[model samples]
Target: MPRIVLHDYFRSSASYRVRIALNLKGLAYDQHPVSLVAGEQQSPEYKALNPQGFVPMVEIDGERVTQSLAIFDRLDALVEEPPFVPSDPPGRAHVLALALTVACDIHPLNNLRVLRYLKTELGQPQEAVDAWYRHWVVEGLAALEALAAPQAGTFLYGDQLSMADICLVPQLYNGRRFDVPMDAYPTLLRAEAATLALAPVEAAHPDRQETAQ
Candidate 1:
């Protein structure tokens, strides 16, 4: 297999999700950090690699994969041992539904580009922008908490950590970043705590600092 190279930013929740997936699968990859805050994602060189100019682009065996969900599916197909999606039909559908609840229904509105546009173009005040962020998070999380019942085991669906857990950890991380109160979702809090206890997941945490050069 050709070396897997991931173009990502440490702070991006999308990139963070992919990183967690890679770590969970025990796949080794090279990291090429793209600083979204510094406008590096919009440069001609990076744009040529990804016209969308988004973080979390993955190059695997010379095939470039864009979109976090697509990249995750590819990784899941490549390594079948630790399955990310459930095998049973109904369970699989439920897991995918929960993952999409976060990836599609919630994440886009809170993306960095959208926030930047809100501040610069719409001239939305910081308080309003933050309110928007919290609103989506709280609404989405309420639905997700309902989906992740106490009947479910340590992880989201059951004892095993599936894609839903992978998606939830980063979104919860972002929610705390934005000061969205999490006390309402005790099940989600427990699931996140259990998922993070795993060695691979803990190693992949975004805040883990790199050594000085």
Candidate 2:
């Protein structure tokens, strides 16, 4: 096996997803902690490695990959067992839709950079920014609930864990941080509970990581 190095921050939801995917794939990797809160991602050192300066950057096979979903897709291709998305077109699209709902729709609007931009750049008070976070989370979760509930069984898609579940857990962690009321999305809550209960998934949790604050 080739050496794998993970460049990440402990609290980054994107980094958290990559950790979960690696644990799920049973791959081992070294970690280099980059503090987003302290603006370490803007340093020249990390910028040389990833011009985008994004967390969850995975280096393996002489290549550095950015973006959590891309890393997950690569890992699934790397290891055949416990596939991330289904083999069939429809199934793959369905699962990817669930994952994208969180990644593209929910996460972008509420990530740390956006929140900081809201506060420092836009001069929005913390109260309004927090409300902005909660509102988007609720909307995304409601959409996920509707889409996932129909196919959900033990996990978000079915009994087997997919990329959707990997993406879902991290978003829920943020929703909890923002104190968004989640009780209404019983289906999502059930899937989240099931996903977090897995030992591998638990091992990748932000609080459990060595670099956690």
Candidate 3:
């Protein structure tokens, strides 16, 4: 096994998810923090590694892997101990659908770059930007609530921790950080609490990271 390096930001939801996956798989890796706020991700050197200039880029043995979902998939293939996705096609699709609902629909709309664009380019007020963030989180989480019966199970899909739980935990972290009210989503909140109690997830928390302010 070669050395693995995780290039990520502490508060980044995508990075957080990858951290959980790596820890869950019991993989050892050095964390190289890229300060997204300080604009280090856009630097010439970092951009050379990742053209998209995104956080959560994993460098394994010399090869670079981008995208959170892809990284988790590769990790699953490499280490079969704790599976990342379901084995069956339907089960896999179901888990990925839930994961993508948060990663694609909710996260993109409220990420740092988009929020900055709203504030800097569009000149949106803080109140309006916050509203925008909350609106999307609530919308996406409502659908997730409908999809999951978390009270019956420890995780999003079930007893087994799947990609959906990995994805949902970070989204909940972001939601709470933004002070978005999640009272209406009981299943989501319950699942969030349960998921975070796991040692890997707890270790991967944003506040526990070295870059945390």
Candidate with maximal TM-score:
2
TM-score of 1: 0.95
Candidate 2 regions exceeding 4 Å error are: none
The 10-residue segment of model 2 with minimum total lDDT is 73-82
Clashes of each: 0, 0, 0
Candidate 1 lDDT, 175-206, residue by residue in tens: 99999999998888888999899888887778
CA displacement after TM-score superposition, residue 41 of candidate 1 (Å): 0.9
Candidate lDDT (C-alpha), each:
0.88, 0.91, 0.89
Off by over 4 Å in 1: 209-213
Candidate order by TM-score, highest to lowest?
2, 3, 1
Question: Model 3 compared with the native: what TM-score?
Answer: 0.96
Instruction: Compute each candidate's TM-score over C-alphas.
Output: 0.95, 0.98, 0.96
State the lDDT of candidate 3 residue by residue for 38-142, as single tens digits. 999999999999999999999999899999999999999889978977788877888888899999989999999999999999999999999999999999999
Residue range 13-128, candidate 2, lDDT tens digits: 99999999998889999999999989999999999999988897999876999999999988888888779998889888999999999999999998889999999999999999
Error of 3 at 86 (Å): 1.8
**Which 10 residues in a row give candidate 3 its minimum summed lDDT?**
149-158
